[model samples]
Target chain A: MTDVNSVRPQARAETSVRPEEVLLPPVDVIEDAAGITLFADLPGVSRDRLGVHIEGDSLTIEGRILLPAPEGLEPIHTEVGLAVYRRVFTLSKELDPDRVAAEFNQGVLKLRIPKVEHAQPRRIAVQVA
Target chain B: MFYRSLFPRDVLAELDRLQRGMQQQGDVSPSIRGTGRGGYPAMNVGSTAQSVEIHAFAPGLDPASLDVQLDKGVLTIAGERPGVLPPKEAPATVHIDERFSGRFRRVVTLPDDVDPNAVSARYTDGVLHVSVQRRAAAQPRRINVV
Candidate 1:
């Protein structure tokens, strides 16, 4: 069995090299009747490189999007303003592990996390006594 | 062990040794792509009640070289952005770079209910925005109070 506690720190350290990749956009979390929706920005990433991992209370999202190298003339001077985007979030206890889903399109990452069935409000039928 | 009934002797023998050598290498890369941004031009996306807007942040793609297509609910942005200067000899320790250049492709999958025919695309402010409208059945419709 893998010890996530040990592995997680190493993964976290790897992220330090490309700190800018940690540029997670402002997340809009909406909890409606259906589920919780989280909107995250992921630029330059491809469908394949996008990663979503779940471990108990931890949810990790990371991808390394490579920017195209400059063309025509050789790079005499270069400043890479934006390289890649990466971020991770801790999942709340209410999250229904079985119902977590995500999709990435047009630089936006969508996470649909349904609340645990018990945590969700339920309607109780009343009987006239 | 169950599969041994199918494979030849040599192949099955290799499988046993292979299993002994294999080790957990840990996670290699992100399942989501663009994790390694790569050679394509950057693009932006915006979503609203009416449409999901996508913009390619490219300044060098020529109008004539651009080709946009929406096929089977997939939006593909393709264009050839010509490189500037084409690299030239410079004095000692000289290196030059301009941001935009080369061919790029960005393919995005739209929701099942997107109306491909009603889409609108334009290149303005050096950004190519493709607007895809939601299909009538999926769009919000006002109920008549009468």
Candidate 2:
């Protein structure tokens, strides 16, 4: 069996997130023949504040969500929810860095990475010639 | 994410009282506030031939109040959701926290190939939609079609 102890530290860091905090934005993963698509909700987020980087087999997304502070007067009994999301992904061999792309709209983040062409199934054509 | 509607009867009643209370306290009060996440906003992301599309769920936030910017491959949205209730003389009471207000900001990084200049954003049905087109050279073309 694979050794779980070897990767225990990495897994702990993710769950060690603060108690009052929530998980990074909820991410939806959809797979097709091409590759995987990732989407996350990030209300009040914008292009200037978003960041994405990939290293080896790991991809990381970094973002800051500045809670909207109420206007006028001191924030008495404050409950402004402030948040920042940091998520990582372990890519499969099908991933191709050269074809990776990302976009942000409103508060949603999207990523598209085309799979290695050879990894996809071929519509095998019979040779009539 | 679900932010309760300020228009709901219960929320409306509380808002009315909050407005009155604010007036008494001499504070320019906000019309609404959500105690928690207000559930969550719905989001969808997809791509087209020339661009990628991202839609966020924020009902009270309109396009006019929304600000978008792109830099260093990152997309950011920042804006204020002004009090939606009509100006009132009474102080405001926030019994139900459904409306999200204040200087909210959300940031996202685009792919390296994005042509920031080609990015466009729109709002409809309280949903903000953004389209970021890719540079022709960045997208691989079909070499052969069977």
TM-scores, in order shown?
0.39, 0.41
Cα distance off (Å), candidate 1, residue A43: 15
For candidate 2, the per-residue lDDT at B139 reads 75
Show where candidate 1 strays beyond 4 Å: A1-129, B1-39, B86-94, B144-146
lDDT of 2 by residue, A1-129 (tens): 677766778788898887645436556666666776676556655567778888998988877654322222222222223456677888888889778888777666668877898997688889997
TM-score of chain B of 2: 0.59
List, residue by residue over B1-146, the lDDT tens digit for candidate 1: 66556778899899887864452222243324423233455555545556666656544345567789999988888877554322345211212232335667877666678888898876543446677887778867899998
Q: Model 1: how many Å of interface RMSD?
A: 19.8
* Per-residue lDDT of candidate 2, residues B37-56 (tens digit): 23233344455556766655
Residue B45, candidate 1: Cα error in Å is 1.9
Backbone collisions counted per model: 32, 39
